[model samples]
Target: METPERGLLARLDGFFFVLAGLAAVYLAYLTLREGITPGWPMLLVVVFWVLVSYLVLPRVHRILSRVYVPDYFIGRTRTADGLLGDPVNLALMGSPTQVHHALRAAGWTRADDLSLASGWRIVTSTLTRRSYPQAPVSPLFLFRRRQDFAYQQEVDGSPSQRHHVRFWACPDGWFLPGGLRVDWLAAGTYDRSVGLSLFTLQITHKIGADVDIERDHVVATVTAADGTATVRVLPDFFTGYHSRNGGGDLIETDGHLPIIDLSRVDVAGAPEAALPVVRIGRPVQTVVGSLMTSVRGIVYAALSSLALIGSRDADEVTAATSVLLALVLGLGALGDLVLAAATFAGHNWSRLLLCASSVLGVASVVAERLVGNLGGPLHEGLLPLATSVLVLLALSSDSAREYALGRRRRRPAPADQPS
Candidate 1:
C-alpha cells in the first residue's frame, strides 16, 4: 500500500513532538537525581518508576518507532506509546452507521469513549468485580488517531474478562495491502485478566495468546444477528505469525482476513457509536497550555505581591510608581488565572485570549531581538521564552481549537433547548 505523505505542517508538528520528547527526558533525569539525593529509597524508586514508565520510556519508544516502524497501512494497530499493538485481522464494507447497527444487533455493547469518568468507572468496577457493560476501552491508534469506536461483550458478568474489539474508519481512497477496498479495519482481542504491561510496567489488561479465537467470535456474532450481512475471507492476507502485543501478552493469528459486508444490513434508529468522536474529552495540548498559563499567573501574582510589600516605605515618588505598577501587574495576573481556568473548562474565547497573549509576548521578544536589546534569559531563548512559544503553539493548535469548538457546540443555554 502507498504511504501517505505528510505536509509541511505535519513536519512542523514532528519537530515539536521530538522537542517534547527531549524535554521530557531532561525532566525525568532531573527528578530522578533530586529524589535520590533526598535518600528516601522507596520514594526514589517509586518516583523513578512513575517518571520512567509514563515519560521516559514512551518518549524513547516514540523516537525509535518513527525511525523504524513502517508508516504505511501495515495491518496492525499502534499503542499511544508507539509500540506495535494488536494486529488488524478484520475488515468491513459499510457506512459507520450500518456497522454500528449490525454490531448492536449482534448483542455487542458499545464501549464508552475513554474519558476521565469512564476510566475511573472501569478501574473501580474492576476492583469491586462489578459489571460495567459499557466500560471504555483504552485508546489504540489507527489512521493517526485513536479508534473510531469499540464494542465489547462481558463474559460471566466479570468486569475483568471480556471480548473487545477496536475499529478504525479507513481513510478515503485507502485500500488493503493487496488492492482490496475496505471501509473499516479492526483488531479483536480477548482480555483474560488484568496485569502489568511488560513494556512499560503499567497496569493493564492481559490478552489471550490466540487472537484468532476472538476474530472468529466477532464474525459469528455479527452474521448471526443479521441475515442480510455476509462475510468473505482473504486467505493468507498476512503471514501467519506469533508475536507479543504492546502489553507483553502473547498473540498468535492465522493469516486469514475476514471482510464483513454490512452494507445490506437494515438500520432504523439513530446510530450510537458512529457519531464524530468529538466527545472523547479534552486534548493534551489544551491541558498543557492551561497548566502553563496557571503557573505563569501564579508567578506573576507572587512577584507583584513581593514588589508591593518592598515598596511600602520607599520614598514618595518611588512608592507611588511602584504601587501603581504592582497593582497593574496584579490585575493582569488575575486575568491570566481566569483565562487559564476558563480554557480548561473548554471556553474558546479564553483559549484565544491565552493564545493572543502568548503571541504578544513572542512578538515583544522578536522586537527586542531586532533592536539588539535582548539579553539575560530571554537573550539566550531560555525556559521562559520557550514556555511562551509552547503555550502559543498548543493553544493555537487544530486539536485544541476543534475540542473547544466541539464543547461549545454541545453545550447550549437551557432556554434554547426544546421544552
Candidate 2:
C-alpha cells in the first residue's frame, strides 16, 4: 500500500513576492496622480508605506542579502528578510522530547505555528491586551531553515511582552566552533514592547537592550525545573559585543553561552516519530516566479481570445491569418499555465523551463529596445517586461534553486516490484 499523504499545500510565496512589487509600483503611480491633492496624497503615502514595508522591502532585502550575508554559522539567526535576527546564546544536548518536557515543566508554553488564523488571533489579542499563551512567534532561520519549534512565556497577560526562545536541530556531524557537538541550538530574546521595525518600518516587537539577561533568564528557568535540567555555561562563546538585530533594536550581549542538558529530564507523551519529516516547501522566489509565468500565459490567452473575437469583420485572408495566430498563441499560453502549475508543485524541470523562457523573454525585449533605438533602457509595454524580470529574478534566486534541488533529492524512490 502507498504511504499516508502529507497533504502538503503547494504554497508558492513567490506569487505574493511578485504581487508585492506590482502593488508597490501601482501605489506609487497612484501617489503621483494624487500629488496635487492635499490630504489624499498623505493617506496614500501611508498605505504605500505599509505595503512596501511589509511586502516589497523584505523580498528586496532577501535578494540583496544573498550577496553580502555569509551563510556559514555566525552564532546568530537570520530573519525572514535575511538580516541578522538574534544572537545564538543558548545550546542544548538532548532529544526533542526531553527538551519539550523540560521546557513545559519550567513554565514555558510551546508557541502555535504561524498561520493565517494564528496571525489574526495574535493581532486581535495584541490590540485587546488579551493573553494568548500559545501565540506564535516570528520565524528565524538557522541552517537555512526556520526554527523547528519555539516556546514562550507571555508576561502579565499582554501579547506585547514575552520571553521567547527558538530552537533548531543540529545537522549531522555539526558542532559548535570549539568542537563541542550539540543536539540542538537555540536563541532566546525578551520582547519588551511592540514598535515599528526600523529596517523596514513594519510593526514588530522591540526586544530588550541586553540579550545576556534573556539568555540567563532562559537557563535559569530550565534549571529551576525540579532538579531535572542542568546547565553548563560556555563563557565567551562569542566575544562580548553590542549590535542591533534585524529590527534595528539595540542589543548587547556578554558572549557567554549556556548549554542546557535536558537528557535527564522527565517523561514525554509519545515517541517523536514526526520530528524528522521531509521539510520541502516552495520558496518565495520560486513561487513568485512561477506565478509571474502564469500571468504571462494569461496575457497571451487574453490577447489571442480578443484577436479571435475581433477577426469577424476582416477580409478572408486577414481573418484566416488572425485565427491561425490566435490558435497558436492560445495553445502556447495553455502550455505556459501547465508549466507554472508544475513549477509550483516543486518540479525541478518545470522550474528550469520557466527560468529558461523568462531569460529569453527578457533578452528579446531588451534587444528589441536597443535595436529599435526606443530612447529608453527598455522598450514600451513596461508591464510585460517587468513581469518577465520578476519571473527571472524570483526563479533565479538562491532560495528557489535550493528548494528545487532539495525537493528533487528528497523525492520518494520508485519500487522495482509492483504491489
Candidate 3:
C-alpha cells in the first residue's frame, strides 16, 4: 500500500515530468517556426533537462529535506517501504552487525561488519519549532492539529520494550541540553548507527546548513568524554532569535573546538528521534534565485523590443520580437511559479526548470541566428553578451556569495595558521 508520503512524492515526480514536457514542446514550436535545425541544441536542452530533472532536483530535494523536513527519516522510511520496501529498508536501517550475523549464520565467511551511525544528530537548530496549535490558521502549516498527534494506552502488564540506539559522528558526540530522551519501541528495531553516520556526514560535509549563508556565524558543539565540550563556530551563531516568545539573540562561534575523537555509546531512542529530514533556509535561496532570474528575463524582453522599434517592416519585426519576448517571459514566469511551488511542494523542481530554460534559451538564440531576423552585428553580439552577463550576475548574488564562502570556509584549515 502507498503511504501518504509516497503518494505525495509520486505526484511531485509526475508534476515535474509534465512541466518539462510542456517547456520542451514550447521550445520546439519556436525552433521549428524559425526554420532552425534542432539537432545539437535540442539534444543539449533535453539532456540538461533530464539532468536537472533527475539529478539536480533530487539532490536539491535532499538538501531541502535536510533543512525543512524535521523528522525526515520517519517519513522517508515510510516512503521507502512503500516504494521498494524489503531491500531499501534493509539497506537504510539494517545494522552492519546484523547483516554480518545473518551472513555468518548462512555460512558466509566474506560477511563483513559495516560501522554505521544512526539516530538523530542535531545538525543545526533554527528558531523554528514544529507546533500543533489547536486552531487551523494556514493550509501552509505542515503539522496541522488534525494530524501528527495521538494517544495510546498500555493494556498488557508487560513493560514496553525499549530500543537501544546511538548517534555517531555528532559534531562533538554530545547532546543538546535536555535534548535526549527515551521511549518504548512499538516499531521494529535495527541498529541505526549507519543512519546517524550518514546524517552527520551529510550535514557536516556533503550538505551544508543554511546558517552558513544567512547567519554570519557557524556554531558547532562537540562533546568530549568528560561531557564538557566547547563549540568552535562563528561569532554570530544563534544570533537570529532571542527568545521563542519574542525578540532575537546574537549567537557567535569560532571554528575551533576542544573535543576530539568522541566515540559512540549506546542509548535509548525517543519518538522525535525517528523524524525525517528537516530543512531550513533552503527555500529562501530558491525563491530569491527564481525572482532574480525572472527579472533578468523581463529586462531581456525590453531590450529585444527596443531593438525591433525602427525597421522597414516594423510590423513583422514587432511580431517576431513579441513572439520571442513571449517565449522568454513565459518561461521565466513558469520557472518562478515552479520554484514557488517547490517551497510547499516538498520536493526540488527548480533545477529541472532551470535546465529547461537554459536549453530553450540556447535553442532560441540559435534559431534567431539562422533566420535572417537576428539583426545585424549588434543584435548578434548583444544576445551572447546578455546571457553571459546574466549568468555572472546570478552567480554573484548575495545568496550565492554566502553559499560559496560558507563552503570554502568549511574546509579544514592549512597545515599552519598564519601569524
Candidate 4:
C-alpha cells in the first residue's frame, strides 16, 4: 500500500506520461499531414524523441501547472511555536509588560508596539492557526473553467488554518495551478513560515516577527533554553507543478510543539489509482511526437532559409508563409529550451525569455491580422521571422562574450590591483 504522498506522486507521474502520449498523437497528426520520408533516419528520430521526453515534457508540465493550477496551492502558510514555545508562549499569555520584555529579550525591537483592539486578537490568532473544515470533498475537475480544492487545519475545536488551492486544466492535459493564497492565525508569538515554491520561484518577505526586509527567502529564528539561533529552511514545490516548480518548505516548531501537516492526500481504492499506465506501452507515441516536432522545425527552417535566399523576389504570400512557419517552429523549440535552462539555472532570465517569446508571437500575429493581410502569407510569416531573430540572439557567441565581459567589468577591483 502506498502512502498518501507516494500515491499522489505516482499519480502525478502517470499524469505526465498520459500528457506525453497526447503530445505524441498531436505530433503524429502533424507528421501525417506532411508525410514521413523513406530516408528519415531512425537515429535522428530517436534523438529527437529523447529530447521531447526529457526536455519538452518538463516544459509542458511547468506551463500547464502555472496556467491551470489554482492560486491556493501556490500560496502556502505554516505556523509553529517560536523559542521552543516556552518564553514566547509565556509572554503571549502574560501581561503586556512581560510580553514586551520577552520581545526585547528575543532581540525584537518594537518600534510601534501597541495593544490590538478587542476582537483583533481573535482575528490574528485565526490567521496563524492551521485548521481544516468538515466539508464534502468533490472531484477537482480539470476540464472545468474554474476548479477549486479546499482543506482546513483545525485545533481545539476552532479553525486554525485554511487552504484553498485552485487550478484550471487545459485541453492539453496540463493543469495550470493558480490562485494559491493562504490565511492563518497564530495565537501568541508563534514561529511561522509561509511562501511559494516553484521553478525559479521567489520569496519577497521574511517569515518571522523580526523580519529582515533585505532577505529573499524564509529564515527561522530558534530560541532554546540556553539561547536562540536563527535557521533557514529552503523552499521547494510539493505538487500541482513539475519538479522544476515542485518543492516544499518545513515550517514547524523545532522543539516539542504540536505541528500540523496539511497537503493533498490520495485516498486508497480511488478509481484514478486503478487507471492503467499509458506511456510505457506506447513507445511509438513519443517517437511520433518527436518526429512531428522535428519535421515541423525542418520545414520551417527550410522555408526561412529560402526566404533569406530570395527575400526580394518572394511575393508577400511566400515571405509570410516562410516567416509564419519559422516563427511557430522557432517559438516551440525555443520555449522548450528556455524552460530547460530555467529548470537548471533557477533564475529570472528564463521567465523573461519565455514571456518575451510569447508576447512577440502574439504581437506579430495580431499585427498581421489587423493590417488587412488576413489571407496573405506575410502576416502569418512575421512570427517566424521574429522567432528566428530571437533564436539567433540567444545562440550568438558574441552576445555571450559581451555578457561575460560586462560582468567582469562590473566586478569590484581587488585590493592588490592599484586602487
Give the top-scoring candidate (lDDT). Answer: 1
Q: In candidate 3, what are the lDDT values of residues 256-276, reduced to their tens digit?
A: 211122123222241222322
lDDT (C-alpha, whole model) for all candidates:
0.80, 0.78, 0.30, 0.31
Per-residue lDDT of candidate 1, residues 1-419 (tens digit) = 32253354345445555555555554455445445544443365576677678766766687788788887777778887778999998899898889988888899998998888999999999999999999888888888888988999999888799999999888879888868899999999999999888888888999999999999999999999999999999999999999998888899988799999999887877554454654557888899999999998898899889879978889989988888888988987899899999999998779877776776665555566568764332223434555666676576655777788788668866986673
Runs in model 3 with CA error above 4 Å?
1-285, 288-296, 308-419
Q: Cα lDDT for residue 133, model 3?
A: 18
Rank by lDDT, descending? 1, 2, 4, 3
* Candidate with best TM-score: 2
Q: Which candidate model has the greater lDDT, 1 or 3?
A: 1
Off by over 4 Å in 4: 1-335, 340-345, 373-419
User: Of models 2 and 3, which has the larger TM-score?
Assistant: 2
lDDT of 4 by residue, 255-300 (tens): 2111111112222342231211222121222223233334445665
User: Higher-lDDT candidate among 2 and 3?
Assistant: 2
Give, for candidate 1, the lowest lDDT window spanning 10 residues: 374-383
For residues 187-250, could you state the per-residue lDDT of candidate 2 as single tens digits? 9999999899989888889999899888898888889874868889988889999999999999
Clash count, candidate 2: 4
